[model samples]
Target: MSGLTNNTPRPIDIRLHQASRLLEIKFDNNMECQLSCEFLRVYSPSAEVKGHGPGQEVLQVGKEDVNITAIEPVGNYAVKLTFSDGHNTGLYSWDYLYDLGRDYEALWLEYLGRLSAAGIKRKES
Candidate 1:
């Protein structure tokens, strides 16, 4: 399936491995990514985390122990992720998820930099 952009691909499969604390997503184009719950939590697309505008994103710290408690489809375009920390507002669109997967490394490094700049440290469980 095609997505929002011409290059984006729709997700074909999604699996949550609670024991491994990972969420795996496979797209129709055969590209796949395995993301940790901690990463998802910190990069949540919700207003509570991402804020309403650019430069307003709240730096999410202490989410190393966080886990996704549920994944509810929000129609054919997105899924609402419920975090164990009580965050469930972000509706992860197909495009957004694909971007997350494709840009995991850079995004993660950016997150780490933000944390470091903010003098925050992730708390491991």
Candidate 2:
């Protein structure tokens, strides 16, 4: 069990820009992704962020100022995000990250709509 598994990544690159709150992920297959901090926060894979299931996610609010504090690699296929807001349980897999990037716009709007419905405003930092 000491040896690496067959699925061990040959290569993957994740670049984070603190000023921009953006992550640029380059896959081994040549696919590239650009993701925003807000996008990543709402789509966090942690139960506190995502809830137990669909339709149960607790809407993340007041997070307009949140930023990634660190990107810790998990094995070969995922990374753990340490957020400035103190959330670090979300284990973001490559597949999940890809889906988040692909569905960014719709998801973000939905989240904003939720905020509006709850009378929550993102405070300026």
Candidate 3:
């Protein structure tokens, strides 16, 4: 995953809606997205999920009901999310978050494909 770039739009506001299990973020560039907690958890930038290099991605499973327990800011560039499943290693930078929102459909579909191919059925949320 890429880090912050010169044109990366910073988040103007970040709100966690616990009841809805969504993270609503609005960027300075007028872009906004509501990302599900499950989506964020599975796409976490942590080494445990992303691995150290290419083709080493560890497919996350059974995270449909996972929710964010905490959101701690790391400097001005990123936020560290603590999930209910105890995952708190990923530093979700602004650019990464933006990309995730921008590419959500494709990423989510890919994840679903992987799960299907592995014969892993996601629990209903």
lDDT of each: 0.88, 0.79, 0.94
**Model 2: what TM-score?**
0.82
Which residue runs of candidate 2 sit more than 4 Å off their true CA positions? 1-11, 123-125
- Misplaced by over 4 Å in model 3 are none
Candidate 3 global CA lDDT score? 0.94
**Weakest lDDT window of 10 consecutive positions for candidate 2:** 1-10
Q: Write the per-residue lDDT of candidate 3 for residues 1-125, one digit (tens) a residue.
A: 56677888999999999999999999999999999999999999999999999999999998988999999999989999999999999999999999998898999999999999999998887
TM-score of each: 0.92, 0.82, 0.96
Error of 2 at 67 (Å): 1.0
Question: What does candidate 1's lDDT look like per residue over 10-125, in tens digits?
Answer: 89999999988899999999999999998988888888998898889898888887889999998888999999989888888899899899999999999989998988876656
What's the candidate order when arranged by decreasing TM-score?
Answer: 3, 1, 2
What lDDT would candidate 1 get against the real structure?
0.88
Q: All predictions: root-mean-square deviation over Cα?
A: 2.5, 5.0, 1.0
Clashes of each: 0, 0, 0
